[model samples]
Target chain A: MNPVELKYNKEHEYAGVNGNIVTFGITNHAQESLGDVVFVELPDEGATVTAGKSYGTVESVKAVSDIMASVSGKVVEVNTQVLDAPDLLNSDPYGEGWLIKVEADDLSPLETMMSADEYEAFVATEEH
Target chain B: MIGTKRTPIYEEHQAAKAKLIDFGGWEMPVQYAGVIAEHHAVRNKAGLFDTSHMGEIDVRGKDALAFVQMLITNDASKLHDGKILYSPMCYPTGGIVDDSLVYRYDTEHFFIVVNASNADKDYAWMLEQAKNFEVTVDNVSDQYVQLALQGPLAETILQRITQVDLSKIIYYTFTHGEVDGVPCLISRTGYTGEDGFEVYCAPEFGRQLWRKILEIGASDGVQPIGLGARDTLRFEARLPLYGNELGAEITPLEAGIGFFVKLDKEDFVGKAALQLQKEQGVPRKLVGLEMVGRGIARSHYPLQKDGEEIGFVTSGSFSPTLNKNIALGLIRSDLAVQGDVLDVMIRDKAVQAKIIPSLFYKRG
Candidate 1:
């Protein structure tokens, strides 16, 4: 089970908002689906991202998939650790596997995202 | 849409929560726990794989040896009972139709396992060749299910459920035995480069065999592997896939599988063309490549030398064993050398790559 503080995108990304900056990473379910994460091309700091748009690319052992942004914001910080050790996404997706920190353009987008409980139910439906 | 065929263990895979994918028109399990985890399970302990999607054809009659010798590039007469031979079924123009494993049950009976996608094509080709000989070819693909128990501890784990003395079953040889009173054909052959066995049995009895093996080997870390890991493992071993490595355009000699082709054999479908190629030397050869820089090389990716397109990648993946991006490509014989640097264009970027010898992983 994941922590309750974070919000999830329909695409399986988890965003934890704290003040004006929001930290985001892929959920455990997403990591499991992608298999072993081999490489991560993170968006540059200060890059603007729009909701539901491709923010970066994540390459797994099998194929490369685009990482869709869940919230509109400007990238404040990029996780260099994930670029070096992409397996962190598989091991600690919610914590150390955080991909980037974004300075939110508006906090209203968070309301559109599913809460932890709702995300779990959403994942359950997907499994069926 | 192509009709996706289901294997005998299709339900078993679903019950185990395996990720199913359409593999060559077969609804096969691509992964269970995960590709890497399942791959490691096979490498370190044991893994059970449902390989029922692979086609099995039985060739039986008075002239089975002669029939096979005329169909495949390998000499079937050399194979004794229980012995297996690997070879390519080629076209008259020196192109590979399919690569398969032939098991000689006796002088007049032989079983051949070909790739699933090439079942109809391979069977038709064999029938065409067998028209003159007293041979009857039967496609028994749906009648049987194949389960592969691979890895270091595969033998020890399998021995617990079976009565056969697996130790006596040498490599490339098979033995008919019973696992839980169900008759099975067990052979010490695998695609993972590790020591393992492939079990062939009736479709109804296959489920029981899978359950028994998992139940007995669960304590020892035996896991259900899928086609995803199978591909990665085989790729790391540099095992050629039919459509990728040995295609209609590529000859087996040029694919680095000349060891399996019996040039001295009296005659075969592609003997003349292969002999000519052997005498004149093949123009192109398949080689392994290791990415030296960022970006992954995939199938059909253009390989360039000094900005000139030389060849294209056939099969590639991020190798879990090597922790690097690796690929296989057919390049001009002169360019297929070890330590030679090349550029692989991946999404408009020329990633630095180095050509290497085949087989990224070797059993220690």
Candidate 2:
């Protein structure tokens, strides 16, 4: 099951904030839409990612989609496992598939992120 | 969206919860389950495809052989009864009208299957060309439903339901018979590299046949494949999709299927122009590429050599069978040599790729 306590973005990324460090990955909904993750290209550690900007890309058998950063932060850690085993994104999007760890410049953007219940409703609307 | 066509087995696709997409004006299933899984299923076991959108045209008359010989780039006069020949119908300027398969029922009767998107246009062009010869061209696309049962297990699965001894129907040949009491024409042909059959029957019986085949083959792991895996399967085999590999502007010689072009046997459409173009040499040719960099090279992605644009990818995908990013690109013939290194511009990033032979997969 998805971690219910984590904050979610409309672009289908979930972020877990422990103090100023935010650990984030694409949501289960995103992985479902993009079947069979074959490759994942992530930003290197020490790269600064802006809120509402693309920081990486995920490719499946059929197509590729951009992975967006939900909050302004400097990437402190990159998930090396995902680079070698991309299918982990589909199998464990909330846990071992977590993409990057970033130290946030401000936690204000986290306030604007939706709760798990709100994100579910948002996905329902998007499907329609 | 209002007038897009639907095939006889459209309901079957819906029942499976397939992801539908607009392909050549037909609302066809792109995937059921998923593309990679479906692709592997076809490569390892068996998969069924709803190919009803392909257009069938009947060409018959006293002068049918001569008329067909004049129309296509292949030597149609060589085909005997029950044999099928793949050919490209071209314009006088060496531009393709469509790549089609010609089935010889007799000297006076031949059936041509054209690409779905080019159905109306191909019919119109044939009619316009018919004025110079004595023959009748009938577009019978709406009357038949086509199913492609493909893979290693295809023969065993189909043999259980049909009375027409599958062994007698050699590759590139066909025979008429009944499947589950439904009259049909079964051909040992397929676009996928695997050995398979293309079953053509009455439109009304499509759904029944689809379900029965799936039910019979269910225990053997038979899956109802969609257009997504169909494309990848064919692409892996180096089979060209009309709009992508062969188009109004791309000649068969330039596309690297020149073996089908009979330049010496008969004077067909595009013969004179193709002869001249061949003498001067084709400026561009199709080549296969494998991504050496971390990004996928998608269709229409620009190709560069020494930082200058050379060509663009026609079809590209992550090959499930090969487990690599592969692409077919039309680039300058000079740069088409094997092992040549080039760069594909994916979005704004440049990805390194190496030139390889066009055929990516071959069945053992």
Candidate 3:
């Protein structure tokens, strides 16, 4: 089971919110779907983000895909470690694999995201 | 939109939680655990693959062998009964039409397996060539399903179900036999560069055979592999794919597959053009590349020398066997040499790469 503290987006990203700042990373399911992560292009610090928009790109061994922003915010910090060790997304997607921390424009977007059970159900439906 | 078709095993792949992707024109399973894991499984143990999406054609009549000989660069007359020959069918311009495996069942009967995406075109090409020969060419792809059991333990697992004495079957040989009472064609050939067998049978019986193999070989660590591992395994072995290493524009000699071309064979299509190219030398050759810096080289990625495009990658992957980025590129014949250094443009960045010989891994 995934940790309850981290909220999941419909796109499979997990964000842990604290006050106005939110730290986000992809979920284990997303990492598994992407295969072995080879490279991560992270958003720059202080960059503005819009909910449901692509903020960065993640490349796997086979193909590249965009990492979608789940909540509107200004990027507070970016994880450089993931650039060097992209496999962290597969090993520890919720912890060390965190891509960025964002200072949110508003926290209301959190309510639109899914809980663990809802996300699990959503994934199940999509698989079928 | 995914414009690929699905095979009979599509539902089975979904049930196994395989990640499906568009391969050629088929919606096939790319991987279940992952490409790396499945690749390792085929290397160390047995891996099962549902290769039903591949095209199978039947040629039978008095002039089957003669007809096939005129269509391919390889000499079909040299193939004995129960023997398989790998050859490239070419156009009149000496460019490859497609690479295929020809199985000679008898003097008058033969089977050919081709790449899925080129099935229709290959069939049409064969029909056009068959007008002069007294042979009937039938595309029987949909009537059959193919299952590949590959690895070091493949023989052991497969021997449990058949009474044909697979141990006596030499490499590139095949036999018609029954597995669990189901009629099947078992061939001792594989693309993973391993000692394995490919089983061909009716679609309904294929599902039963697959399930039976899994049920019995579960203890032996046999897992249903997907196309992800299939590609990586073949890549590591330096096997050529139709679209990547071969196309309507590239000849077998240019792609470094001249071993299958029998120049002395009685006149065949593209023979004159290939003879001319052989005398003058092929313009380009396929070479292997190993990335030096941190970047994955991919298909169509440009190879640069002194700030100019020298070649482009045909196939590339992060080799699970070598644990590094590896690629195959078509470059000028003069520039194709082992240990030579080049640069690959990846996302506007030039990454250092070394020209290595093909087949990054070979089993002892």
The prediction achieving the highest DockQ against the true structure is 2
Q: What lDDT is reached at residue B281 by model 2?
A: 92
Q: For residues B152-262, what per-residue lDDT tens digits would candidate 1 score against the true structure? A: 999999998888999999999998999778999999999998899999999999889999999999999999999989999999998999878889999998899988889
- Candidate 2, position B201, lDDT: 98
In candidate 1 the C-alpha lDDT for residue A49 amounts to 93
The per-residue C-alpha lDDT of model 1 at residue B354 equals 92
Off by over 4 Å in 3: A1-11, A14-22, A41-56, A68-85, A100-128, B1-6
Instruction: Mark the 10 consecutive residues where model 2 chain B has the least summed lDDT.
Output: B292-301
Whole-structure CA lDDT of model 3: 0.89
Could you tell me how far off, in angstroms, the CA of residue B211 lies in candidate 2 after the best superposition?
A: 0.7
Q: Give a tens-digit lDDT track for model 1, residues A7-41.
A: 99888888898898989899999998888898887
> Just chain B of model 2: what TM-score?
0.98
Error of 1 at B11 (Å): 2.8
Given candidate 1, what's the lDDT at residue B145?
87
RMSD of 3: 3.2
Who is ahead in DockQ, 1 or 3?
Answer: 1
Candidate 1 scores an fnat of 0.67
